[model samples]
Target: MQATNQSASAKPLSIRINRVLYGAFVLLSLYFFLNGSYQDAASNLGLALIFDPFNQMVRWENRPRWQRAWLLVHLLVMAGIGLVYWKTFSA
Candidate 1:
């Protein structure tokens, strides 16, 4: 009974710790994104480009394979930016 009460009491503290850790990770990633030098941007951009669909057309296509691939690439880029943005505002 006492052990259960003690364990339950510790849950909030554990949650708080997790929150702090996540916040720190976000801030660090943002710092890398924003304060990162031109070389950093170039590297990340190059990495992003690798996933781009070279055969994709901007207009309508018979199949969505290229479109879907392009969308996935953009989504990843946006996610990266969002992480940085979230950190920029969180601070």
Candidate 2:
């Protein structure tokens, strides 16, 4: 019984940690986006989506059809930006 209680308590703590990390990733993504670092922003956003803090942000089931499709759109846009940058700047 004591072990069960400890396990239950630990679950919420882990969830809270995940939420904090997800929030940090989301903020980092926004910062990168504002600075025109599309690749980094997309990477961080993808991480946040994968971590899925609280299941409240970036969840496919919680979103409308268009919003769910936006994930792929976002990735494609970022890839295009990266390709442009590489072609323009790479040796």
Candidate 3:
């Protein structure tokens, strides 16, 4: 138990806060999307991106193909969601 506590406390405060916010934003985005609020989902997703959830800390050229693909797919999906929201509500 003491080891676990020490490990938990080892992380910097900002990183902990970021992890919590990242989770919250991702869940919020999902909630909004499921309830037919595409605009809200897209906006929340954009906010989540600011937290860099994909974590490209590794050098881009050295990263595995799947990592690159996942990030690319995520960005594409975000763009798709924004386009959908725009089309649905635009005048």
- TM-score, cand. 1: 0.41
lDDT of 2 by residue, 16-84 (tens): 888898789889999999999978887777677555455343456777786567556556755766787
Cα displacement (angstroms), candidate 2, residue 59, comes to 12
Per-candidate TM-score against the hidden true structure: 0.41, 0.60, 0.57
| Predicted candidate 1 versus true structure: per-residue lDDT over 12-91, tens digit per residue | 67666655654554445455668866335533543444333333334545657866675565567666766777899999
- Candidates 1 and 3: which is better by lDDT? 3
lDDT tens digits by residue: candidate 3, 1-80: 99998866765555767778878988999999999997788778767766654444468788889877856765776788
Candidate 1: worst-modelled 10 consecutive residues by lDDT: 49-58
Q: In candidate 2, where is summed lDDT lowest over 10 consecutive residues?
A: 49-58
Q: How large is the C-alpha RMSD of every model relative to the true structure?
A: 16.3, 5.1, 6.5
Candidate 1, residue 39: Cα displacement in angstroms equals 10
Give me the runs in candidate 2 sitting further than 4 Å from their true place: 55-91
Better structure of 2 and 3 per TM-score? 2
Runs of candidate 3 with Cα error greater than 4 angstroms are: 1-12, 54-56, 81-91
Q: Please provide the root mean square deviation of candidate 1 (C-alpha atoms, Å).
A: 16.3
Looking at model 1, residue 61 earns an lDDT score of 58
Which portions of model 1 show Cα errors greater than 4 Å?
37-91
TM-score of 2: 0.60
